[model samples]
Target: MSKKIREKKSTLFSLLFIAAVILLTLWSLSRAEDPDKLIKDIQNASPVFLVLAVLCVLAFICLQGVVIWLQCRSLKLQESLWRCVLVAFHGYFYCSITPMQSGGPPIQIYDLKKEGIHISVGTLIILMETFLFKVVLVILSLGMLLFGHRLMRRYIWPGLFFFILGTILTCGIVVLIYLSMFHSGLLRRLILWLFRKLEKHHLVRSKKGRVEKLISAMDKYRAAAGYFRNQRKLAVLLLAVTMLQRLAYFSTTYFIYRSFGLYGVSYWTIVLLQAAISICADMLPIPGGVGITEALFQVFFRDIFGTMTIPGLCLSRGITFYAQLLFCGIFSIAARVAFRVDKSRLGFFQTSFIVPEDAP
Candidate 1:
């Protein structure tokens, strides 16, 4: 299919998914004795907590920029921090609309190329950032499984089996991606062997070009691995920053819980639940994990907090996902406008900063 058709389809699906999520959230609330009263209760909850929840969401957005900035600096890219922030918002806008966030990296790479970074470097930066992000996610989910298995069995749907399966799959994918960049000898042999088999079966016209591309990517990965290894301190700092980024993002749930004054579950337990939700969401094909998040929230919190699950879902999603979606969507548009204006003034040749040809 054409790109335009795919985009239109994605837009249509995103709209429908978002509507479904809204309806599901409403339905959850409607189960209450009085839905309006429950909303009123949420509104009447601690104002401080509400504000903190918003701040935490905002912090989450900013921390993504920090992760990119640090990784870019490690690669010797001199892009401005504001550019990183714009990239984060712009990526979020696309990611929120596309299924499984498949649209995000391309947009980010396009934006970075416009800023004068080479496409190759931009891709590496994104890959490194994504690797660290996935690492943090896998670690958090494993922590939940190890320390909160009882809660998982009791609350999460599909119980321990589902959680373990999802977490293992996610971690395995991440580990393979990481290993591909640094230790790809086995992967390269396997890929080449598969391509050779296809050629022998007359399935492919030519294997030479595709094999070259695979080798090129393997080289890029090796370079990235070596560069990062030489910058061990920066690598450690990037990991820590990524962890903080997730904590700030997930802490939105904690603040939202406090906003409703339901303290039955400890903060740690809530974090674990949020981690599980994230793991499940990754497994889902839905855009923004809309329906899946609502379903998981209901399943995970209902028995624990009774009717408070309704408000919890409402406030948690309202403050975190929906709020971020709306705000970042607008910010992305504004950034594009500003970038266009700046580009017009600077001319194409002057837009990008020169990097050393030999540098990774």
Candidate 2:
């Protein structure tokens, strides 16, 4: 296909997906029972807890930036913390809008390119971030499931199927990443086999150039993986930071739980339930997992919040997802504008910052 035709089709698909997300959002809102009571509960919610919830969201965003910034710095790249934060917001904005966050990494790589980071390096950074995030989430979710089995049975029994499926899918992704990084030969052979099978079935045009490009990308990814292999301490530090990042986001629900003035449920219990909800929601191919996340939240927290479930849902989704979407959208736009202005004045040049295969 011609480049212009491909672009047009992509745009059309994005528009349709956005329209679907809007409809889903409306449907989710329609599921809320007793708007009057929801509003009353909101009115009576503690302002302090609400503020803390907002801060937790902010921390989540900023800490992700910290992770990115630290990665860049570790590689001797000169990325400012503020710019990294903008990149983080840019990622969140695209991820929220696209199915299963499929758009986030490409746009984020583009954003990093504008900062003079090479495409391979940006891809490596994103891959590392994703690997750590998934690993942390899976570990935490499994631990919760083991220790909090009773809680899971009581609150999330209905969604057990989804929880299990999500866990398996998440583990599959982690294993794939590990194989791609450490066992590239096997992954390459598997990929080539699949490609040949597809080509034989006439599913894809026999594009030798595409295969060459894929091989080239994999070689670069393996080279980037070497950096982590040598820098074990940095790897550990990033993993620790990732754990804190996940916890910061998970804590939002607990604060929202407190905001409703309901008690008897411990903080860790709420955090674990939120973690479970995320595990179930992450694998769904929905934009921001909008309807599904809200539904899961209502299902899991119904007993805990009792009559205030709807209000808690409103507050939680509003602050975490909708508000986040708005703020990240603005930040991403601002980042784009800044990049353009800088390019106009400085004459932007593409530069490659390849990580050395054997660096100290």
Candidate 3:
């Protein structure tokens, strides 16, 4: 396809995705048993706690940007913190609209390319970030599942199947990444073996060219992995930042619980419950896990929120997901425009080649 045609199609798809997210948000709002009562309750929520909840979300975004910036710095790249934060907002915008959050990393790599970061290096950064986040999330969820068994049995019993599925999927991805990093040859052999089987069944064409490209990509990936393996301090720093980022996000639920003026539940309880909800939501193939997330919130916290369950859902989902969608969407567009203008003023040429010495 022509370049301009491809750009237009991408823009069209993004607009359609945004529209779908808006409709889903509205549908979730309509699910409240009493719309008027829900509105009243939300309006009456403590502004102080709501603002804190919003700050937690901001922290989540900023911390992710910090992680990216740190990764770039570790590689001796000279990118600024603000620019990296914009990259994080860009990621959040796409992730919230796409199913399984699958569209974010590729688009983020494109954004990073515009920033003069090579695609392979950007891919490695994203891979490490994802790996750390999932590892932390699994650790936290497992802790909650083991210690808070009664809590899970009491409230989240119905959704136990989803929690298990999400755990398996998350762990599977982590294992695949580990293999790609430490056992690239074995992984390459396994993948090519599978590809040849499909080829034999006449399921694929142009096997030679595609296989060559795949091998090249895996070589770069393996090189990047070696960089991380050698930088133990940077790896540990990234893990710490990832854990804080996740906790900042999970804390949003606790702040929302406080906003409702109901005070019996401990902060730890609310945070762990939110963590459990996140585990169940992570592997679902829904856009932003919208419907499933809301349903799980209602199922898990129905007793804790008492009669205010629907209102809490509205407020919590509104701030964390819908409001975030709006903010990140606008920020992504503004940042893209700013980038284009800056590029135009600088009159720089785009360089797509990666220097061997600069690899990783």
Candidate 4:
């Protein structure tokens, strides 16, 4: 199958995967002996806690978009904060749909391009956003492993090892491949290999017609990365901001737990699990890996959290993921409408080949 065709076909597999996860999670929840207790637990949750969750969630959504916005601006592409937020939300909305959850950014770029953004810049925005997020994940996962060694030994060593090994392997590959992109077809070959694997897995199939498109896009990415490479200071600043943004996200969860009058048992362990879950979800091809993430959270925290764990997990997930999904959608709709997006001028939807600052 053509790469695009294969990639497209993976959507179905992702849907099925998500369905399975949902079923398993529900069954697990049902067996909780006190499934009814969760509702009461939620009812008993502090309103202040809920409010704090929402606010922090909103901040996370904004920072998520802004991290990319800053990267775009660094590249001399400019989109309004409203535009950036819209892009981010619409991406999440799409992510919420498929298991392999990585499709949203490309969709966002496609949409943004229709709004008149340059395709190259849109691609850059998405690439930097993704790259920086991965880097931060590696950093955060490492920190938790180091500081929470005690808990890691008892509750999370297997998962932590899985995550750490995966992180190292993935980062090493990305670094080797991306750097090679500018020098030769080596990086392009790596992309093909990766995509081919996805295709083999029915994630993204091979598309002969798309070879040129994909290669050209990679060239643009290489160019953009080269530009960003020259700006060491900008790179540092962007990294710092993205790091802070992720830290803030974790802290929000921390405060939410705190507000619940709950304490102890390695909240940081939950944090690592969350990081690992998100990474795993990317491979699942389910939009945002919704069902998988929830299930994994329940499973991973089972030992640490006991019976009310699912509810706590759900409550936390509800306030965070669902909240971001909703808020970003509303914000994007309002912003797109207020800004008067001209579809024809922008181009319909397609993957971004560059950062999105040039969109509109």
Q: Find the candidate with the highest lDDT and give its number.
A: 2
Q: What's the TM for model 4?
A: 0.73
Runs in model 1 with CA error above 4 Å? 1-9, 184-222, 338-360
Q: Write the per-residue lDDT of candidate 1 for residues 1-360, one digit (tens) a residue.
A: 998898779778777778777887677568754877777877777889988989987887788888887766656566667878888888887777777666777888777766655555566677777788788889888777677667767777554555676688788878876876556577668877987899889998774577786666555545555666577788798899888888887787777777777777788777778777888776556788776777777787776557677777888888778888898888888767654313322222111332322212
List model 2 lDDT by residue over 1-360, tens digit each: 997698558746765776686676656665656667667789999999999999999889888889898888877776778988998898888788777777777877877777766566677788788888899978977886788788877988999988998899899989987777667678768888998899999999987598887776666666666766778898899999989998889899899888877789998889988999889988778777877897898899989988888888888988988888889989988888864313322221122425322211
Please provide, for model 4 over 143-192, each residue's C-alpha lDDT reduced to its tens digit, 9 standing for 90 to 100: 66678577667655656544566567547745653455334356668876
User: Which is better, 1 or 2, measured by TM-score?
Assistant: 2
Q: Name the regions of candidate 4 deviating beyond 4 angstroms.
A: 1-24, 144-148, 158-173, 180-221, 265-273, 279-282, 303-307, 329-360
Clashing pairs in 2: none
Cα lDDT over the full model 2: 0.79
lDDT, candidate 3, 108-140, per-residue tens: 787776766656667888877778888987897
3 against 4, candidate with superior TM-score: 3
Candidate 1 vs 4: which has more TM-score:
1
How do the candidates rank by TM-score, highest first?
Answer: 3, 2, 1, 4
- TM-scores of all candidate predictions against the true structure: 0.81, 0.84, 0.84, 0.73
